[model samples]
Target: MASADSLSKLLRCPETRQELRPLDDSKLDELNEAIRAGELHNHAGDEVEQTLDAGLIREDDAVVYPIRDGVPNLLIDDRIPLKDSD
Candidate 1:
């Protein structure tokens, strides 16, 4: 359950080698469960990737984002911010 700030810095695409800046963690839990229950699909619907890549959606208008590795980077920068705001 990594925070959004941490996830942002660690998130990266394996194919295009691009960095992903998705926005909700609490909501992300639903996605993770959906992926597990087969309710939702992956980048290639109906087919899931082995990696933690998962997927992303705006999730309402509150900025609920996703994460990778074991942490979530919510910061709006390339490097992890030392201080995060609530």
Candidate 2:
């Protein structure tokens, strides 16, 4: 299980290019499962209602993050295009 602090270091905004804080521990776990399961682009828990980082909450011994505004955008869009080594 990855720590929220490590996950926080892993996360970054797509458009803003800013570091993202773990929504919560529970949300972090949910995010881990979701990412491994291909649920969303990346693990970005409910940011609509809950704080960017909230208290830990457990469910079924699993973390469940609230879906905010029906979307989770955690991917960083690299502006620099890949250069072909032709």
Candidate 3:
């Protein structure tokens, strides 16, 4: 997992170009649960099948970038689009 300070300095939303913050624990857990259930999807409609070890949420909360093995996967096509209810 990437440290909050490092991630804040290095990550941004690929689509929105918004700054990213480390996802809070509760939100991370919720997202992980959704991923585990195969319920998470990206903006391009691709299913997210991998468990999220860490994540960064866009400043506007519109998307989440998964951090795997301490690296932020900021690819536009891999970003998880956040719904109003998520």
lDDT of 3 by residue, 1-86 (tens): 99668858776666667789888889889998998998988767888888889888889887888889988888878888786643
Considering only N, C-alpha and C atoms within 3 Å, which residue pairs clash in candidate 2? Answer: none
Summarize candidate 1's per-residue lDDT along 1-86 as a digit string, tens digits: 99777966665543334455553456455555655765543322233322234333322232222346745434332122112220
Per-candidate alpha-carbon RMSD to the true structure: 11.4, 15.0, 3.4
**Which should have the higher lDDT, number 1 or number 2?**
1
**What do the candidate models score in CA lDDT, each in turn?**
0.40, 0.37, 0.82
Best by lDDT: 3
Clashes of 1: 15
Which residue runs of candidate 2 sit more than 4 Å off their true CA positions?
Answer: 1-20, 42-75, 78-86
Residue pairs in steric clash, candidate 3?
A: none
Pitting candidate 2 against candidate 3, the one with the higher lDDT is 3
Candidate 1: stretches off by over 4 Å: 1-22, 49-67, 70-86
